[model samples]
Target: MKYVLFVYGDEKPWADAGAAEREAVYAQWGAYESLLTEHGARRGGNELAASATATTIRKQDGQVLITDGPFAETVEQISGYMVVEAADQAQAVEFAKAQPGEVFLRAVHDYGLDHLAPAEAPPGVRYTLLVYGPGGQETTPEQAAASAQEHYAYIELLLARGAFLDTVALQGLDTAALVRKPGVEVLITHGPFAETVEHLGGYYEIVAKDLDEAIELAKALPEPVVEVRPVVEYSG
Candidate 1:
C-alpha cells in the first residue's frame, strides 16, 4: 500500500528563525530523507512554497473565482508531503511516527494512473493542486460513480494538455492517523483530524507555464476548493 505523509506546521516560526536555525532544520530534514531512502520506502515527495504563495480557485455561480491564499485559515498549514510504499497501515504509521511536527497519513487509492510521468522542466513550472471538500459525507453508489466519471474526464483533459504529472486520491479520514511530536515522545492519534467543514481529499501535481495557466487548469477539478502552490526547487 502507498501512504501520503502530510507534514504540517506553523510557518511563522520558520520564517522568524535565524540562518543557523534554518540550516539546522534543513539538516534534520536531510537526515529524515536519508532514513526513508535507506529503508527503500520513499517513492516521491516535494516541499511546497509557503501557503501565502498559494492561489485558490473555485467555481461560484458558474464563474471561476481565483484568489490569493489558502482555502481555509488555520493555525498550522501543510509544508510538504512524502509518498511511501508500505506493507500495511501499521508500517505506514511507524513511518509517520518518525516524522517531525504533525503528520497526517492517508492511504492512496489506486486509480491505475501511476504510469503517467511528470512533464519535463522545459514544459513549465510545477504546481500542486490541493483538493478540499466536506468530509464524512455519505454518498450513494450512483453518486459516487458519477463523481468518478467526472474526475476521469477531467484527468483526460489534463493528460491531453500535457499538464498531468501525478495525482493521488486518499482514503477517508476515518482511516487516517495523525502523528505529533511535542516533546521527547511522539504521540499517535487516529484521525478525523478536526471537525472542520473542509478536509483535504487529495492532490494533483501538474506542470504549467505559469500561475495563470495553472489556475485555468485547476478550475476543471471536480471539487469545492483547489489550493494551488508552486513546488520548491532545490539545487544539489
Candidate 2:
C-alpha cells in the first residue's frame, strides 16, 4: 500500500530556534528522507509555502470570492508532505514516527479518469492533494456554518468537472491518538500528536492529467497549504 504523509508543525519553533537547532532538525529530515529512499518507498514529496501566502477561494451565487489568508486561524501549520509505499498501515506509521514533525498518515486510492464524460479527458494517473490547515476548533458556530457552506459549493464544482474521487475531513486534532513501538512493546498516546497552531483538517483525492492540473485544482481550493502528491498503484 501507498500512504500520503501530511506533516504539520509549529513553524514558529523552528523559525525561532538557534542556528544549531535548526540544522539539527534539517539533519533529522535528511536522515528520514534517506531512510525512505533506501527502502524504495519514496514516490513524491514537497514543502509548501507559508500559510500567510495562501489564497482561499469560494464561489458564492454567481461570484467567485477570494480571501487573503488561510481558511482557518491557527498557530501550527502544514509545512511539508511526503508520499511513500509501505507494506501496510503499520509500516506507514513507523515511517512517520521517524520523521521530524506530526504526520497524519492516509492511504491513497486511485480512481482512473476513464469514467469521466467525453469532454473531460482521462488522466495518466490520479493525484492526491492533501488538504492541511486549522481544525476550526476556535471558530464560532456562525463562522463554522458559513465556511461549511462555501466548502460544499467548492466540492460541487469539482464534482461537476469530473475531478472528484472522494474526500474525508478529520475531526479536530484533539481527537487524535498516537501509537508507537519500542522493541516489542507498543505505546499509545492521546490528544493532538503535536502542539501546533494547525491540524490535519482533511484531504481530497482527485483525478488529473498531471501535476500541473492537480496544482491548478489545488490553487482554487478553499484551504491553505495544499500538498499535491501522486498516488502509487498497488501491485499486490
Clashing pairs in 1: none
Indicate which candidate wins on lDDT.
1
Candidate 1 on 1-236: residue-level lDDT in tens? 89999998889998899999989988888888898999999989989999999999887787778899988787788989999989998999888887755798999998888777654543789899999888988989999899899998988899899898888999988779988888787888888555688888999999899998999899889987899999998777
- Which pairs in model 2 have colliding backbones? 75-197, 76-197, 76-198
Candidate 1, superposed: residue stretches over 4 Å from native: 119-122
Question: What TM-score goes with each of the models?
Answer: 0.94, 0.54
Which candidate has the top score in TM-score? Answer: 1
lDDT of each: 0.88, 0.65
Q: Where in model 2 is the C-alpha error above 4 Å?
A: 112-236
- Please, what are the lDDT tens digits per residue for candidate 2 over residues 164-216? 86565555554354644456665656555456565556666677776567667
